[model samples]
Target: MHDSSVFLIEFGAIILGLGLLGRLAGRLRFSPIPLYLLAGLAFGEGGLYPLGTSEEFVAIGAEIGVVLLLLMLGLEYTASDLVSNLKTQYPAGLVDAALNALPGAAMALLLGWGPVAAVVLAGVTWISSSGVIAKVLGDLGRLGNRETPVILSILVLEDLSMAVYLPIITALLAGVGLAAGSLTLAVALGVAGLVLLIAVRYGRHISRFVSSDDSEKLLLVVLGLTLLVAGIAQKLQVSAAVGAFLVGIALSGEVAEGAHHLLAPLRDLFAAVFFVFFGLHTDPSSIPPVLLPALALAFVTTLTKIATGYWAAKRAGISARGRWRAGGTLVARGEFSIVIAGLAVTAGIEPSLGPLATAYVLILVILGPLTARYTEPLARRLTRRPRPEQPLAPPAQATPVDDQDTVGRT
Candidate 1:
């Protein structure tokens, strides 16, 4: 009874705090993400106070949060959309990887955390926050812009890459031998490929299985299936997030639409818990020591992300303004960055990684919206060249017709 009381008190406080923080963010026209992280820091270890009983529940909720995030993201596009984007926008995806991923890898290695940490950090830096970007686009009314599709295509490619990247990272973190790791990776890939094929070829049948006329029944059925698939994927050395994503992709039509609408509120709630949960694990005091490096990394990656967006938009033949907008829009990294860092933190790969990632994400999430709003104007202001002044044109004369008439008469 005593432990249960404490759990209720703590968990209740967490939910209430998240609600208030979200309201505050809405009022301030800011993303609640950084505030949620700060709240977690305040209530987590090495902060003002710590929860005694709710941590376990928060952790479970956090995992669910990640699954829902990827799942909703997958619902935004169809299986056909994924294949089309992969085929057409692959060059941009490659450029996104090369330009953005290397900075984090270099930072990790430079810090003497070695190769595994390098790989983890590379992912942290590489993927942009699709959630954040989507929200910003909606907020700023950029959904209809010429470069928006280009941006969406690039984001789709990144999410697809994760279907492969997460499994390999899972194998690496497991500390298996080379052959074992290769086998694990092969299994993971095979599973993912098979899921995709199923989604593409038999998606309608899959949707029919989960489809229900009632929202309550549909929610329970879809949620249960997602959790089941995610658990099985984790057991098979695959990414639970990826499994959830594939499940989402397999459903289409009214079922997908209904699932998205019904599940959005739940997704938001759990996702907030997840961000706070990440913060709870990271020690606030540790963040200060790595704050400088995190800022530097954030600065460098902001430019790299911008460069990536610009190149992609230009390739798609976007106008200068649209290209600049695209680059700026991609600057912010949020949930996925934390997800990647969370994996490293859980594996005890580098003690400083959690703090560094926390600080890095906090910096960019705040800066991301501002840049998205201002980048085009800022770029135009900075790179614009003044035109030379021209000589004044001679005043028009009215005597020419009269002169011709006089000469003819003479």
Candidate 2:
């Protein structure tokens, strides 16, 4: 068969699988992410068909997906919203990061992986899928409720932390077995910091130009800025997603409504390609032995997130039920985890660990939405009943009706 023919056949199969499996996932009340992974597994190296493309292409597609995802995330918030919600959001964010990372790191070490790998794994698992959580809450009609803002804020902070976390971990992984000078680290940090500043400072200005009456101009400018920042971040050894996210964040406030209008279609189009390519790259043969261990890790990671998030919410004076809901809602890890694992692989990490990482992602992507769905009822069950109302006093007499009666008597 011709290479083109083979490629076309694989591509067609992937599309068919995604459409079929997506519906199946919805019917089963599962998240689409897992379905995408399943589709990938079915059509990948071990499956009935293989596209035989280079991993580089898959990676590129995934990278584009991350950028668009982040861009959409940024479009959801304004700078003001971020500042206002920081108090409630920051604590939960910290707790989420710590709980996931600490245990993950320990598990990796116990599994004979080194500190760097463990740390990277921990960092990766720390992020909850904001997209999944938001959708769940929205479906439950909880968008404007008290917990909504808090959860949203935490997700935003997580996104920011990840932007910084990626480069640091990447550098650490790259510098393994060698001394990384302070100069190199400083340069990386400085470059990232400067880029962030420019994005935020100039974002509003760029937004005004893009939000003008012309749709084509709006799209061109936005795409241009996105690509430019992505390029700069890559050149500086930082993940382009980080740059893309910052640009989105900067434009977030100014372009809140307009950005959405322009980018929504683009986001969906690119995101589809990203997921399709992601599925195309999986090597299913690598999954079996690591499956059980991956499941165990997923269980542990989810439980820890619940516990920590509950405690954090409780500390913030949330009701017991609210705490439970928060915990459950925060359980699912997503894109960030995969990115971290990919970085590990690039750093010459052990091949055995790769399957474990993929399995963990696959499991969470499948279970995250299901877990999120049940959070509300569970929260209600665990919350305390409302206190009884106090009795009211009897009504007081009006000036004995004295004056009116006396005047009317005549």
Candidate 3:
């Protein structure tokens, strides 16, 4: 009874704290992610106070948080959209990877963290925060902007690439033999391909099968199926988040919309927990030692992400203003960065990696909204040249000879 009471108290406090943080963020017109992380830090290993009973529960919720985050992201588009984006926007995706990823990998190598950490850090810098970006778009009312589709396409490609990237990273971190790793990669790819194919071809049927007039039944069915698929994927050495995303892609139409509405609150709640859980595992003192590196990395990657967005928007023929907006919008790195770093930290790849990631994400997540709002205006202000004033042209003199010119014809 005492333990149960303690668990209830701790969990209640967490939820209430999250609620207050969310409200504060809402009032401040910003994402609650950073505040959530700060809260986690305060209650974590090296923070002001740590919890005992509820930590386990928070861990489980954090995992689900990741799964739901990817799943909902997948639900935002159809497989046809994914295929089309892959065909057309792939170059932008490649450029994004090359430009943003190299900095983190180079930093890792320069720090002598070895090849594995370099790869992990590369992933950390490569993917932008889809969740944060989505929120920024909605908040700033930029969802209807010309550059938005270009931004979405780039995000889709990044997420799809994860189906391949996550498996390879998993295998690498495990230090499995080449043959075994290849087998793992093959299986992951095969499953992902099959899911995408089905989503494209028979998505309607899948949606119909899952759909119901009753919201209660619909919620239960969708939630259960997602968790099941995510679990199976994890067991198969693929990312559970990928599995959940595929499941999301397989459902479309009203069913997808309904599921999105039903699951949104849950997604927000657990996602906050996920960020907090990430902070829970990092030592506070460690963050300061790596703050300089994190800031340096944040600065470099911020520029790279802006460049990537600008390039992609320009390729799509967006106006200069829209291109700048697109570039600014992609500057934030939130959930996915931490997700990649969490994997590396779990593998015990580097001691400083987690703290650095935490600090780096904190900086970007806060700076993200500000940049999204100001980048274009700032760019225009700085690069805009003053137009020279043209002297007013003298009024044309009245043609006194007009009558004489007409008289000859008359």
RMSD of each: 8.9, 8.9, 8.3
Residue 353's lDDT in candidate 2: 64
Q: TM-score per candidate, in order? A: 0.94, 0.82, 0.94
Predictions in order: lDDT: 0.90, 0.68, 0.90
Off by over 4 Å in 3: 393-410
**How do the residues 27-78 of candidate 2 rate in per-residue lDDT, one tens digit apiece?**
8755577667666666666776655643445556667777877777767765
As a TM-score, model 1 comes out at 0.94
- Looking at model 3, report the run of 10 residues with the lowest lDDT sum: 401-410
TM-score of 3: 0.94
**lDDT head-to-head 1 vs 2, winner:** 1
Q: Name the Cα RMSD for model 3.
A: 8.3
Model 3 agreement with the true structure over 145-178: per-residue lDDT tens digits: 7788888888899988888988888888888899
- After superposition, which runs of candidate 2 have C-alpha atoms over 4 Å from their true positions? 1-9, 53-59, 83-88, 176-203, 253-256, 276-279, 346-348, 375-410
> Candidate 1's residue-wise lDDT over 197-305, tens digit each?
8889999998999999999999999999999999999898888999999888888989999999999999999999999999998999999889998999999999998
Candidate 3, residue 97: how far the Cα is off, in Å = 0.7
Where does candidate 1 have its weakest 10-residue lDDT segment? Answer: 401-410
Ranking by lDDT: 3, 1, 2
